[model samples]
Target: MKKEEKLEIKLNVQKESWKSLWLMARRYGMSPEKMLEQFVADLTCGAGSGGSDERDLAERWYYRSFEMMGEDTFVSYLCSDEDMIEEVMELKGRITKSEQYISEVKKRIETGERIFVHYGKADKKSLIAATWEELGYESREAWDKECEEEIREEKEIVSENEERLKEIWENFQRARASQSATYEEEMKKLDEFLEEYGKSFR
Candidate 1:
């Protein structure tokens, strides 16, 4: 056998499980460490569709698992490690502002201070009876203007978040590429070490 390069990973398991794994490893004529390495290799080894890389395959599995658990899988997959902190703070700020604005609007509605316009030729009594549209021209105009401004502000908020999300996804893609390149380099070095060891034994 060649002197293969070794990689170590730490896992937390119950004492009984560890004992069982050691027994199983001995039965297979290998150490527990080698057994665990083989297990991990078998679990992760597969050719993804359309020749996708390991990172993409791992991401797909992660997304599927989170979705099965009824979690916000899109948010989980969208933000890179670096983006999460900054983006979450920004989102929280936006949410706070939105909540305050909504509270103010609710207060105005409760106080009957918001404008409601009725343009039909109704008598004063009829106009007063109208539920939603019975305000004077000036009040109606003010309400319409306020609504338009609110809509524009809402759109701007959405657009900004959307752009930030796009940037986060781009950063994640680059990080994945970098990780994949590193993995390939490590594998190549391991293979070379194994080949040299085999030649030395011969």
Candidate 2:
């Protein structure tokens, strides 16, 4: 029989995990590298070299079935990672909530309400109701004027709130600094809180 060529491969893992693995190897009376090699060999002992190719082909067809059926494709995408069932449920829940919100927004628009949309720090905008006639406006010019006025009023309200927020932020900074000996730690906590809050919108 021909001798199999052995190759060395470096595996990067967390420091604590690597230490624990070495401890386990010591307990088993084997070098860490040998233990890992044997562990992997045991895992694939029954699989021939063609096994991976066959597995890949099977997976391809399994996914292709979902693609062929348009209706099931979306469901498959949502359930793609079976290990992350909770994440999938959360995504489905968000979709349901969004559908409900869109229905409400549609009704509001039908009733001649402009749906305001905030885009980052840009000028305020809105989805103007369908048409002048549908929105009960006498003319397109009148509808346009009303939209401009409403948008302008909303911008002014936003500007006022921004100024109020600036003042409140300054006061908050002073208060937080005065209350905490670890002012930097307090600020770091605030940063963490803002990051989590922003993630909710995403």
Q: TM-score for each prediction?
A: 0.32, 0.25
Tens-digit per-residue lDDT, 155-179, candidate 2: 5555554455345445545544434
| lDDT score for residue 114 of model 1 | 45
Give, for candidate 1, the lowest lDDT window spanning 10 residues. 71-80
- Model 1: per-residue Cα lDDT at residue 183: 30
Prediction-by-prediction clash tally? 1, 0
The best candidate in terms of TM-score:
1
Best by lDDT: 1
- In model 2, the Cα lDDT at residue 20 comes to 95
Q: How well does model 1 score by local distance difference test?
A: 0.54
lDDT, candidate 2, equals 0.51
